[model samples]
Target: MKILTNLFSVIASILLSASIAAAALDPVSINLRSDEKNPASPVMGDHLQFWSTITNTGTSPIEGLVAWISLVEIDPGNEQPVDLEDWSAHKAVTGASLKPGETLRTDWPMRLIKGGDYRVVVSVTDRGGRQVYTGPTIQFHVRQKPVLQAGRVLPVAAGIPLLFIGLIIFNNTRRRHGNGRL
Candidate 1:
């Protein structure tokens, strides 16, 4: 009976220690947003920046964490993940460390490439593959602003030459009728 009691006590202490360690290594929480106060409606060709806040809620410090941004198009029949190579110069932030209750803000500057519905998310993960933290999705629509629309340009292109011809004809007629001099 004494041996059994000792064995149970040892097991209980081990379990308690394991739980504490697990709690200390709890995953961090993150929030992602744009610095722009306006709703994230950016026109195509606009440059924008996003801010990500990563907070360590555990009792221990976290190290070797990596953060990156992902963009996915949600437009009808055009859904696909966007590559960050052309959109952003700086893609990922690595080797970030945070202490308990500490918050770190990361900046991601990107240029809007195509006009479509896109969802942006920021994710953080450790090198040990222990935990993957993802922030809320930010949905924004990229408006298409055509700088030179074919429909709008055709009229202007055709009208300019017609105006020049009309002016020449009027001057010729006036000269012919007014003794060819003024």
Candidate 2:
């Protein structure tokens, strides 16, 4: 019984070490960034683009990797994950192979539909979905677009002033001609 227990312990330790070594040998590295490092108050209806760079740092060629971008709204009292189906058309990119030291860059174009504080991240996953690599988070805020009602009130506001000015001028002319009532 003692020998059997020791054997089991040895096997478990070996398996654990191998899994750790396999993780350490993963070759993929990813980085994500946007044109604006930290967008200074992007507004609703704004367009923002992000780039994800995937590199193989190990001595082996990596294959069957998929990368995608994620956006999340982090506004106070209104935090939620964003649905990118309509916001971005180029959400994911797949690489067939990445040779050692080779890099693949993917672009993500997004349109802001809602105003809120947000964060963006890029994630890379293997074909089998066993490994997931995430890049740094980019934070930003989108302000609500300003609404102007000048189109509805401009004519009235301008017309009233112009009419008053015309009346004043007509009254002055009448007074000069011996009719002083305004």
Candidate 3:
């Protein structure tokens, strides 16, 4: 009987702790900025640069700060809210701790080769490793570099012929008018 009672107590304690953990965690902010205004679409490079900011909104400043920001490939164009934890390679955060209600921004230097779609996830833990807060992920895009492309030129490649043809046609029509034709 005592054993049963003790087991029930332990279970109850676990449940209570879980509830507290759940309560501790709330929504926070994760911001991402890119170097290139038009980052490579199908990004082609050894590494792409990124700047990220991780903020905490909980009542107390979080400690033992460890986070991950992943870049997952997204559909090329349309805007989407990406899940930061989805399909990420697992990159750790830089700072060690964050004070309650304070926003600590991390530089978040990353190396990305492909450029389709990507996002950033900011998660934090307390000193005892209790998950205190987790923020939603933000998505972005990367484009392929133009210089390495075999024949990826601007409008000039398709424009020159059209311009010449138009000019020739105009001049020919003018000549007919200048000659004795109506």
Candidate 4:
């Protein structure tokens, strides 16, 4: 009975120490935002810029941190596991140590390849692989460009030549009827 009690006490102490260590490492906060005003719907073939901000909120400085941005496609109807390797772009490594209360901002620029539903995920991890902070997922849709129809194109193309012809006729008539100076 005494041995059992000692074993339970040791387990509790280890769990408590782990919780304290995790609390001490909770010093970094990450936020992600896009430069596009309407990130929910971006036009296909347009360049999109995403910004990630890493702030050290604790008193101790953090070292050897790395940041990355990933793009994942979502199926609106079914449950599918997001494959991180699907389409990922942009990775930045903080070469210098981050001071307490300091912020580091990184930009990831990617061109829209096709029209579909997608999400961007941004994350920051410490060098020791003990701490990881991930920002909220940004859900967005890429829309195809509007098609130009003949109903819209024909009128503009025909109107310009008719205006030029009318202008030429008016100019010739004015020259013939009025004096050269007038």
Candidate 5:
């Protein structure tokens, strides 16, 4: 009975410690907004405007904060964004310190020219160079590019088949030469 009690106590202590560590990793609060009220579609070469407000929930001060947003294609499979010049952008703040119970908000703006849903993650670090908090991944969607879809003489999806054909042709040639059957 004593051994069982000790085991239970150890397990409880371990769980509590795990929770505390995880909580410390990123204790942050975030609120994001956009100018457009309704969900609009995004095409190729479109600029997306966004705003973010980040708050520090930890006891330490935040030295800097960084935010990243990505757009992934929804159709067929969740594909990655194309022609993205800057998938990750950070606010320019040097020696910026945030005391406990303090919050920093920025009018963050970024351009989006991809088709699909996107996930965004924002992280803030402390003056001690420790990651204080990481915000949850935010998701958004983009509209398909109408011009590319219409003007495509060959389907982008066909590239897979073309690649496979090339591989097969190369393999056959190599095998034939290697086996003296060429």
Candidate 6:
């Protein structure tokens, strides 16, 4: 009986240790940003850039990790997510591994075909199917190019000559007063 008790105790301890080790390997963290470095309010037919960072906060290194960015139209009525495979100019970076406490960044560039509200999402997954991370969704708006109208263009066109004339008159007055020449 004494030997059996000791054997059971050893097995239980080993199982507990293995469970702790498994629990330590948690999912990584993901952060997504939309043109945060140099923000631009894009319009239709404009190219938009996205960035994402995957950080390994767990105790173990992750291998065969894949990261991707997705875009969806949210406003002006919801639409299905855009298929990146269909986009000829879309590009994304993928990584193979991320060590503990290490960070990897990926960039995605896409062109705006329609102008409306949209959202960008970033996600990362590991090969072992043990970890998955998803970053927060970023919302943005793409506006259509403003229509050119005579009412808006004529004032600016008229103002340019007026400004030039004012500058010339001011210069002439200054010259005449300071040097006694007109």
Runs with alpha carbons beyond 4 Å of true place in candidate 4: 1-25, 36-40, 77-89, 145-182
Please give the RMSD to the true structure for each candidate, in Å: 11.3, 9.2, 12.9, 12.6, 13.0, 16.2
lDDT of 2 by residue, 6-57 (tens): 9999999999999879766767777888876535668888789888888887
Number of clashes found in candidate 4: 0
Q: List the residue pairs that clash in candidate 4.
A: none
Ranking by TM-score: 1, 2, 6, 4, 5, 3
The lDDT-based order of candidates, best leading, equals 1, 2, 6, 4, 5, 3
TM-score of every model versus the real structure:
0.66, 0.65, 0.44, 0.57, 0.52, 0.59
What's the alpha carbon RMSD for model 6? 16.2
Q: Tens-digit lDDT track for model 3 on 1-182? A: 99999999999999999987865566345566655743445365544455566676556666667766654455756546444332333467644766656776665545545446666555555556554455556565666565644366546777898899999999999998899765
Error of 3 at 54 (Å): 2.9
**Candidate 4 per-residue lDDT over residues 68-157, each given as its tens digit:** 776776856743444433233554556557889999988877777766788887878777658678777887788987668889999999
Local accuracy by lDDT, each model = 0.86, 0.84, 0.61, 0.77, 0.62, 0.77
Candidate that scores best on TM-score: 1
Tell how far residue 130 is off in model 2, in angstroms.
Answer: 0.0
Best of the two (2, 6) by lDDT: 2
For candidate 4, the C-alpha RMSD (Å) to the true structure equals 12.6
